[model samples]
Target: MKVAVLALQGAFIEHEQVLQRLGVETVEIRQLKDWQQPIDALILPGGESTVQMRLLKELGLYEPIREAILIGMPVLGTCAGMILLSEGRLGTMDIEVRRNAYGRQLGSFHTVDTVKGIGTDVPMTFIRAPYIERVLSDKVEVLSTVDGHIVAARQGNQLATAFHPELDDGTRLHELFLGMVVGRSDKE
Candidate 1:
């Protein structure tokens, strides 16, 4: 399946590398035009939400992305990307983010914790991650958490994670996303 990684900024290249390792065709998304191409899934890598939001506005992708999510396009957001997927954020996020919820970047580290639906003690890497303070709807399901803070969630075909799954060499999350893509296609 073909997956597109938002390359506006952040660790998008790392996501692309992980996808490539899984033997999936990957594309770097630099413009709204990149979204014109058919893709089975998309990834929004960790980065500064303020900058990413501005870039989205500059590229006219904010609404398109929202619309795509509504239509059931599978999306995976990490760190700052996770902040974007939430219904609301804690502090004055560029586009409404929680901001330094997991402390500073230097405080980033890896952990093996049990998630709600995914599995137990999964290795998760956090770098200045944002914690999910609240879920807006039943359509969203919490997938993982650390110390009772929600770290991963899935709203229909959309998935968001506070940690960098790509950096961990664990393909389970990617595989889960691929499953979502495949399941959606089968239903259609």
Candidate 2:
């Protein structure tokens, strides 16, 4: 299976490395043309959400990608990507996310937390992360929380996390996303 990692900005390379380690083929999505390729899933890496959104629009990729997600494309959004998916009125996951909810770079931190359905004590690295303020729709499933803050959730084919799972050694979150991709593919 092939996954597309948004390479316009952020920790996209890390996500690619993680996918490669899992023996999954990956393609870097840097332009509108990149979206033309066949991809089993998409990874919106952690980065500055505002900038990513602007770039997405300027590159003429915003609508196509959004339409794909609306049609049930499996997407895993991390950190700023979470904000972009939820906050910029994407409405794909039925979530409400607050950008930089943890403050700025000064507020960045690391913690070992339990990611629901992934097991306990997973390493989570937060760099200017955003938390799910509320799940707007009952269809959204809260996946993990840290210090009472909603940090992860999933709805249908879309998964989102406030923490940068790619910044850590554990690949459980990526594996979980792959599971989502595989599950959807099987149904097709």
Candidate 3:
């Protein structure tokens, strides 16, 4: 029931707040030691992808996190997080993500859309977001799209979204991630 939120950068606190409101225990992961805790799942929040990756490596957390996800540790990645998990970075989620696909900060906006398994009119807030340019694996399921661009997807225990679900009041996305976490625990 405990989730680790990557606090090295970005909207991590927002994710933690949402998870907390859902009554889930959350731990901020800011260092390699934090990753040692008994977390049932992990959240990679939105931020600058390049900086996040640099910190992950410098802090000696990159490989462990990636390997953990590959081995089925449930993870929810948002914005830059989606980029982090894409083909070239963590390389766990088989998707190619284009960073800041929505141009600059001025391009950020909000809208309501349907996320595949989450019902209709899901509020989505995009801030310097990225989009899945192409899915490299058949196992990856496209969850939602905005203006024909892939915005949300799930691959096994890994869930990724270009928009910040934490920024909105909706719990479907976070709840969906919790479902993945519970599903993982059940299998064990």
* Best-performing candidate as measured by lDDT: 3
List candidate 2 stretches off by more than 4 Å. Answer: none
Clashes of each: 1, 0, 0
TM-score of 3: 0.99
Q: What's the TM for model 2?
A: 0.98
Give lDDT tens digits, candidate 1, residues 39-98. Answer: 888888898988888888889888887777667788888888887666542211212236
Give TM per candidate.
0.91, 0.98, 0.99
Q: What does candidate 2's lDDT look like per residue over 1-188, in tens digits?
A: 99999999999999999999999999999998899989989999998888899999999988999999999899999998898789455667788888888899999999998888799999999998899998888888898999899999998998999999998999999999999999999999
Ordering by TM-score: 3, 2, 1
**Model 3 per-residue lDDT at 121:** 92
Q: Candidate 1: where is the Cα deviation over 4 Å? A: 88-97
lDDT of 3 by residue, 1-188 (tens): 99999999899999999999999999999999999978899999999999999999999999999989999999999999999999989999999999999999999999999998899999999999999999998999999999999999999999999999999988999999999899889899
Leading candidate by TM-score: 3
In candidate 2 the C-alpha lDDT for residue 98 amounts to 83
| lDDT-superior candidate, 1 or 3 | 3
Task: Provide the overall lDDT of each model, using Cα atoms, as 2-decimal numbers.
Answer: 0.79, 0.91, 0.95
